[model samples]
Target: MHKPLLVPEFLDRARTHYGDSEAVIATTGERFTYDELGERADRFSAALQERGIEKGDRVAVLDPNTHYHLEAAYGIMQTGAIHTPLNYRLTPDDFAYILSDADVDAIYADYEYAENIEAVRDDVPTETFITNDVDAVEGEWESFDAVLEDAGTEYDRPEMDEDEIITINYTSGTTGDPKGVCRTHRGETIHAYLTVAHQEISDDDVYLWTLPMFHANGWGHIFAVTGIGATHVCTRGIDAAEIFETVREEHVSYMCGAPTVLNMLVDYYIEHEPETTGDAPVRLATAGSAPPEATIRTVEDEFGWYLKHVYGATETGPLITTSDAGRLFEADSDDRFRIKKRQGLAFLGTEIRVVDEDGNDIPRDDETLGEVVVRGNQIMEKYWGKPDATEEAFTDRIEGYYHTGDLATIDEHGMIAIQDRKKDIIISGGENISSIELEDTLFDHPEVSDVAVIPAPSEKWGETPKAFVVPTSGDPDEPGVSEEDLVAFTRDNLAGYKTVHRIEFVAELPTTATGKVQKYELREEEWEDEDQMVGQG
Candidate 1:
């Protein structure tokens, strides 16, 4: 039997088998079972079709982690339209650029973020603007709820090919304008299975929405959790108190976050002394940078939650590796913490290799750094509407591998540890220095809360490592650790050449919506005036 692997089939299965189970708990004080949720999704799909939206049309969604986002995703997929999710953290101009770039036909935005789209509405090609706010349907906008109310709970299902592009996810655009990454039904379906396998999701699990839904489709949790009929507890934003309260109130068993969110929860636990023990210990998957060892210890030891560190980019199903300590090492092993700190082994149905410039695999010595390339069904199909960029990303690097542009090393266990971004590597005195290593070491300091490391121009070393430190007290000028103290501290741990030569105290590090430190932003400022910012050595 040759069945098409469409994403909407996951929802169909949930509706058929788990109809009576609670499917969603919206932060807006509404709850729905799988049957009710599926009916709403079908109404949304019917509404889109009635409004003249056809198959392959682009439908953009701009909202926080809400049930509306979830419904819109399934509805769009059911209608055979490409689901495009915009980052709520982006500026109005950025939204404008992406809307035009993707040729978006319709958009479903939350009332909180509709103004951003309103600002750029006149400049884009969108034909329909739908807002979730039913009370205040002003101007040309239509109420999302009203549309669903007037529509039926059934729509004609179009014949879909597994290779059809179902979603277009935009990159963070740290270097330049964001590129839209194309994902087919087959790729995302494979990724959803992998997510369930890696995260150990089950029907009994209750998932909290700490991660944004717009970020790689919430790292494919929407499908993984829904496909298994797991409960989805939606949150409007990431708030420490609310998260703690929800975890206790709703018995949240599984969630995902970046390191920054983890740090916030740990800090909150330290200051407020929240109850750590629960009915079932929480399982959190964290990525978007290698979290400091201190964070892992605090999360597991103090908060009584298991932390799994995973790694990937928006291009590679956004999850290619995971460091599940319990599976990789003994509970009492001394090297457990050290091993968990590294990005773990390749995920199921994925192949990861660390290679040099010539595309040859590097030795598994854990010392030699190389670019991380991946080949699997989970990889994105291509860059949308950018042939040259797509070709540059996949060709001339490896025959079938996608270059991640992330430098890493593999240990004897075939576990990969990221060193640094290729452009972020500091070549000082003919020695390569990893900024992530320096930041990880600095995070061990008692007074340091957050840190970013960038290469600065130096007459002696051509380019030297500069540390930007955010203190625990949240004051830049009054940082408890002085420059001399930090310098001596680094000298005690790292090599002389890799030690940070300059320290700049800051209130907070600039981060993306997902909480990754924007090192390129800091690097540009430090090297703005230099004729050649890169090291000549």
Candidate 2:
């Protein structure tokens, strides 16, 4: 007997085992038990069937980290349809491109983004629109709540295979056109199991939804938490004040956020004291561009929160590696922070490798740089509607491993430290430089709050490294220091070519909703169709 591990199936199991247990807490002040969630999922599944959405259909969702977004995800999955979550911050053109590219059959959008989706509705292949807000929806879009109102609570579950596509996660394309990464039932199910094991989440834990649900299924925590019968406390947006309130009000024990989010919380704790019950410290799992060592210390010492760092991509089940630095460096505080900066080793059930340009394995000396590659069940099935791209992504840049496009080195301790993306590496005046390295060094400066490094057009040196900076404590309008002063500061710390040549002070750098800086956005404008494309002959 063969059966798929669609997420909706897990809902049924929870209903049978913990029907009365609290499953979710919405920022809107609504709570749902496991049984109630199951019934709503069934009703929504039935509604999808009525709209002619069935097995293998693609339904899109455009919303924040809300309860309805969660329900729509499971409901769409229940019909054996693919759940495609879009970055709500994307421009209308971005929205139009993805909607048409996926040929979505339907959309369940929040009221806030209803207009953006509606503007592109005509061009998109989708035939239905289910707004998240029922009362205030305008235009011809139907209400998502109303769709479930009269729908029967009983519906037939679709028969799906383990290999069937379950979700389409659109990667934040910092390099080129955004490609939708297709994930399968088997891939996600196994990922959920792995996340639980890696995070060590327990039934007594109260999981806080601080990260966006649109982000790789909230790093697959939504499913992992449900699988463990943990309670969910959802927040609408990432506000330092709101998050502090929720942490205390909901007794949030477990949460996950990017370094930026953690930094914000730590900053708030230092500047503004928030009332807390002091029951127990919260545990946080952080990744996305190895957090600064300062952040690691503040989160552990000041906020009284334990920090665990994990690394992955939208393609690799997004949980490929987690640092157990806590176990190895618990005794030495300084060593612990140093070890925490590395991406760490691969998780159980996954394999990783680093190889040279000639497809040879790089020595694990922690100095010889090579491309980081991996092969595992957790890898995406393929890029949706992109056969050539899929084939290219899987090529053996390494001997027989799927090229990850990331450059890294493994230490003797079996820990992998990601250096930078091969494409993002910079070469100035014949000197090769890791942009990430320069960025990290610059980040250590007290004046630099946020920084991104990119190649700028230079007549003499071909392409020189330029930095866009956000100041931590200074008049951002004046940048408080001259370019010469910054260059002097870098020269004290970094090599000659790696010094920041040009500095532009901005209030903030543009970032993906997940807090990843859109460096390519910075790149395009910096080059701006220049005659000699960066470092070209």
Candidate 3:
């Protein structure tokens, strides 16, 4: 009964119980059964060992959403090495910083991203470079396939302690330098169970790789799906047409993405109608930012898919809450749309509280804003090599809770609604304005495709909300909707104080890889000359 909780157990269970079942369909048209996939993972582990990689060594994976990434994950974990996944969207210099920070010893990179690693080859401490594409391999780099061909399938699983760090996921450095969050084998295992239990993944499920595997370990879906023996349908990148086609061809039952990806799919679906709607009902879990109610309605009504809005950060299991419409609201309730827009109840083993600055719980009135703090088994252990940052993150302010840094509110039904980021909240004339509220209202405008709201400098009121709009039609320089029209529209819908005072039409909003808007970037530009930010005043 004292078995150590390890990540490899998931793959071992799938290989033993579902040996002949199809486990993965790669973007390169490679198919593998559970047995074959397991063997490949073992071979990868053996190959790393042959290259002198040992337990506790850091192994970085730089690849897109492919079967090779999946293999690299399990392979690296099996060898007791810490797996560090790199975001392909990052620059070579960004990769260099992370590789050097994590003290990575070896890297398994996709050929498409090999150039990024090669660009920083001399800067990092990594000694071995393995490329999946053999032809792309040159000068001190090893071919992944060639190594697999020569390596044995019998790799000895390294003895691992459950509480030891298994992975280091770097945050998207939107505000500043990215911080590496260290996650242990125990934490990841607990997160996988929570994901499977809450999402209801099964062997009959076909999961499409819409979310990148680099993001919080694909939101821990990589372990959840594999644990249940589900089929993994890999895609190189997110393309609306390809996603729709794969859903029809593979009968994809479940997938996860940010609202931005859903918006792209909906846009494509409206323009070019696809004929084949699969036999099974499709389930999608979306996060990153609270989606507009219109987006949620479209996903449910037009696409006929079940939409679940999940919420969390890279440090908190990346899945601490979910808003399932059927469970949270009446089937025919008019307020269902509004309720579904909330971040919703905490996960099964998680606890969430919205508290005031004094560490007291805020009223469940859904109006008062407070910091949302969480305590759960799935929370990351610490920020790697940043003891000061880790201590500040888990300070006694909340007492045993991890500060989320998200300002939120709790409704009577106990659902949590994120108002805005603590730093992004606009304080104008002694009143707080939630930018998310204004952005949601603007999303209802037919001419507005995407929008970002930031606190712009205002000498009179300290700061005022500024709307950066991306139009749905016409040239970017001259949008269909004018500034006066948008200002009037918000005034009609929101309070006088919350109404956007300034409007600037732009081509598109800046977003992270996961599609969350980078409001801090806009804020920095607006407050560059100012000594302090809006809230500071």
Candidate 4:
């Protein structure tokens, strides 16, 4: 007999085994056990069905890392609707594009961000708008609690296949226009299994929501942690001091973040020198960019927490490899730092290879740079509504592998070290910012004649977008536009995080013989002192 792997079973199993056990400790300081959370999810499912959300309908969640996100997501999936979670940091215009592209049927936004969605409501196909605090939010929105209460805790669960698409996570990445990455029940299920094994999630573990839930579904932690019956301690946003305090107060055992987050904690530790942990042991898994060797050492040696450096993209489950192998190096040896810096061996059931332009495997000399390609069950199924893009991503270098535009070197142990990016993407502070996107925005400025945006190493943000602008004045020293003005211009036009952090006036950008602007020259100049062009810690 064949059995299907449905994601809702994760909650079902918890309710069966640990129903009376605490499941979620919300940002509001409210707690819910597995049975209670299950009921809430059931009611939400009933409400969505009542609102005409049928099988395959897209339902969007625009909330922070709260208990509501979990309930809403499960609810959407329970009715067999696709769970599409948008980045909360995106602008109203961004939401408008995603909502229209996904053809979203309904949305459950946090009170704080509902206005952003409401601003573009008429432009999108989404008709139903629900928020946690309807009274606090302006305009028309049903209260989430009220809707669940009104609807009984019963709804028909459509027949599901493991291959059925259940979630769409949009990546507003190198292309500027966000492409919805479709994930299947099988892929997400396999990803959760792999995440639990690689990240070592446990039943008694107290997991903190330091990472955003919308991000690759919190890098698949929402499923991995819940499936493991771990306690969730939710937070509205990250505060280094508050995180440390939560570690003590809630006995948080495990969390995840990017290199930027690791740096923030280290900075806070150095400045304030607070107690690092509670009775429970702490482990942090970081991935957006590789952490510097120093930061890893500080986290392991000073903070008394284990740091697991990982590597992946939005399409590749964001957890294909981890640098947490302990058998390779001595326990206390300093050599562990170097080993831990590289994105370590591939997880079980995942195959990672560094291939050249000819699609041939590069030698494992730890020096030859090649594009990283992956083939795994955990990888996304395809880009929603973008067949050509999906086909190109899979067929670019090899027939069946997803070619990651990251340039890396593989060692004898098959450990990969990311060095540079082959794509025109700037990963600043763990967020993907397209160089062309920033360049296009800057080119729109009246005072700007020409512009090239590149990644500049930052101590705080790891990598920040730096623009080299040739002002209409044409003189490098006498460029009419001030740096402050350009920075503010970007903030006004785009999301706040995508703002250009630094601007340098240049006489002219370096160009190829055919007159194409050479962005590598600008990148080389910006990252002269760094070993890798990407963020380090």
> What would the TM-scores of all predictions be?
0.97, 0.95, 0.97, 0.81
Best by lDDT: 1
In TM-score terms, candidate 3 sits at 0.97
* Stretches of candidate 1 exceeding 4 Å from the true structure: 134-138, 325-327, 535-537
> Candidate 3 or 4, higher lDDT?
3
Lowest summed lDDT over 10 consecutive residues: which window, candidate 4? 511-520
Kindly give the number of clashing pairs for every candidate. Answer: 0, 0, 0, 0
Off by over 4 Å in 2: 1-4, 275-278, 478-482, 532-537
For residues 441-485, what per-residue lDDT tens digits would candidate 3 score against the true structure? Answer: 998998777888989889999999999888876357868878999
lDDT for each residue of candidate 2 in 1-537, tens digit (9 for 90 to 100):
866576766676777888899998987898999888877888888999888998988999999888888788888898899999999898778888998888899999999888888787778888988987756666787877778898888777877888889999998766567899999988898898888888888877888887788988889986888877888887777898888788787788888888778767766776787763246468888888888888888777767777789998888888888786566786446788888878997888889888898878799899889988887777899999999988888885743456778888898867898888776777677776777777778777767777888888888977888889887753578766666877788888887668878888888777878877777788888888797445331
Highest TM-score scorer: 1
Candidate 2, RMSD to the unseen true structure: 2.1
Q: Where does candidate 1 clash, by residue pair? A: none
What TM value does model 1 have? 0.97
Q: What's the alpha carbon RMSD for model 3?
A: 1.6
lDDT measured at residue 26 in model 2 versus the true structure, 0 to 100: 80
* RMSD of every prediction: 1.5, 2.1, 1.6, 10.8
Which candidate, 2 or 3, has the higher TM-score? Answer: 3
